[model samples]
Target: MNKTNRKKFYDSQTWKSCRKLVLKRDNYLCQLSIKQNKLTPADIVHHIEHFEDNPSRALDMDNLLSVCSSCHNKEHPEKGRKKDKRRMKSRRMMI
Candidate 1:
């Protein structure tokens, strides 16, 4: 999708509700590192999976995460596999 459309999609009401649920579920803490870092309310809601795969999932609290921008950036690796893979790897390591 084009940048404009992508921006619109990201800024839609669905995203807004999804983000709100994530923030509420996590109590506004960054779930990635579980850090209570200060951040704008807008910066808290992050997608656990790509929006393309399941945009509807964004609305599901189970599929959302509260994260600061820094950790979110690290979670979303631009050069390698996407954030979801990294999260799975981390989960496997934990187990």
Candidate 2:
């Protein structure tokens, strides 16, 4: 899907619901971080297969994983987006 369509899909209620379900399934913990034995909270529902490359599986539970933003960045460094220092802290973050 194109960037516009991808954004629209991500912004949809369906995606939001799916994301919540995945996070719940993963216990809101970062699945990637768990691989490293860390205990970070996940705030994103990431596609195991790139959503753009596998749009057909975008909403498939088996295709999703709960991930922290840092892990998500490592998974897709090609995006090259910088972390915004001014972003609000998550309530779930222990600090």
Candidate 3:
């Protein structure tokens, strides 16, 4: 889907309700945090199968994971790492 359509889907009641259900199912705790024996509150419901790759599974509970921002970034680091690399290169140039 295009950006507008994707945004509309995310803003829809269906997605909101599903997001809440996923968060509740995960007990509002980050699954990654729980695995590491932490108790961080989740702020994102991530798509395990990636919505971009499988839009049909976007609202699938089984394909969702409650996660904190840190865990979410770690899970999807392509954008984050590229930005970080750019920043590092810029810093090196400055130095």
Candidate 4:
């Protein structure tokens, strides 16, 4: 999605509720990390399929994923929030 549409979608009540549901369903844990045998706290709800490419599944629960800042950035490098190489390791909770 374009920046304007993306912002509006994120700011909507529908997305707010959907995000909460996805987080709860995933137990607030990063789903990708779990698949790798690492447990991490999830702080963002990500689209498994890019909403920009497939608008029809924008609000589909099956297309949503609970992820952490690190994982989300990995999935969307265009976000330009790549981890700082000079910074210390993140202190995000892990199990």
Best-fitting candidate, scored by lDDT: 3
Give the per-residue lDDT of model 1 (tens digit) for 9-87. 7799977776777777777767666555454333667677766567667566777788877777777777355767889
TM-score per candidate, chains pooled? 0.61, 0.81, 0.89, 0.79
Candidate topping TM-score: 3
The TM-score ranking, best first, is 3, 2, 4, 1
What's every prediction's RMSD, in angstroms? Answer: 9.0, 7.6, 1.6, 6.5
Question: In terms of TM-score, which candidate is stronger, 2 or 3?
Answer: 3
Model 2 gets an lDDT of 0.90
Tens digit of per-residue lDDT, candidate 4, span 1-95: 68999899989999999999999999999998999999999999999899999988989999999998889989987764455532334543331
lDDT of 2 by residue, 10-87 (tens): 899999999999999999999999999999999888999999898999999999999999999888877644443323
Query: For candidate 1, what is the lDDT?
Result: 0.70
Tens-place lDDT per residue, model 3, 1-95, is: 78998899899999999999999999999999999999999999999998889999999999999999999999998866978999999999999
Clashing pairs in 4: 1-52
Roughly what TM-score does model 2 have, to 2 decimal places? 0.81
**44: Cα error in model 1, Å:** 3.0
